[model samples]
Target: MVWPIDLAVLTLVVMVAIGSLMVKDLLGAAILFGAYSFMMCLLWTVMGAVDVAFTEASVGAGVSTVFFVGAVFRTSRRTRD
Candidate 1:
């Protein structure tokens, strides 16, 4: 019952991770990573860990996304040859 749901969440996280790695654009990859964090946070909530979920949602989705975007801004959006 609960195990299945957990497994699905874990699968989603893994898929998002893979997508993030495979993405060529840095900004797009960062967005995917943020979405991954959001999914993981939801999974945590589903597992009855509200505090962990909150932290993950805030830090992972919010803070991490901001940092990644800042890094992207520091560098050019175009890829160099």
Candidate 2:
């Protein structure tokens, strides 16, 4: 396991996580969440957990992102506040 690569991916995961939370747009947040999940998948792959990584990529990044985007599309784009 290369430490630098792991660290870079880890940093990306953290940044994406924070960006997902900070974004005002729901679709943008969902996209960031997908990116965070993909980064986590890479981390899992680096740790030799191919099965877990596949699950994260399929479920966390793929299905959930689609669900979030679908739900976002059904809602009003204007802010409630």
Candidate 3:
């Protein structure tokens, strides 16, 4: 794997992780988490772990993101007194 590309993807992964945590909106955080998962899949692909990469892409980025967004939509934006 080329060091520069790997470093870039790794940097993106870290940035996305932090961004997801820092996001105030649940939907935005879920999108960031999906991006993070996609970056992780790319990192795994660069490392020659194709199976793991596929799993991350499918389960982490795909299914989990859908679930998170759905859950976020279902939740009411209300603060209980």
Tens-digit lDDT track of model 1 for 1-81? 288889988999999999988887889888999999999998999899999999999999999999998999899556431
Q: In model 2, which regions exceed 4 Å deviation?
A: 79-81
Clashing pairs in 1: none
lDDT of each: 0.90, 0.89, 0.89
Most accurate candidate by lDDT:
1
| Model 1 TM | 0.87
* Model 1 residue 7 CA deviation in Å: 1.5
TM-score of 3: 0.88
Q: What lDDT is reached at residue 32 by model 2?
A: 92
Candidate 3 C-alpha lDDT tens digits along 1-81:
778889999988898999988877788888999999999999999988999999999999999999988888899523222
Rank all candidate structures by their lDDT, best first, as comma-separated numbers: 1, 2, 3
Q: After superposing candidate 1, which stretches have Cα over 4 Å from the reference?
A: 78-81
TM-score of each: 0.87, 0.90, 0.88
Query: Of 1 and 2, which scores higher on TM-score?
Result: 2
Q: Which has the greatest TM-score?
A: 2
Please state every model's RMSD to the true fold in angstroms.
2.2, 1.7, 2.9
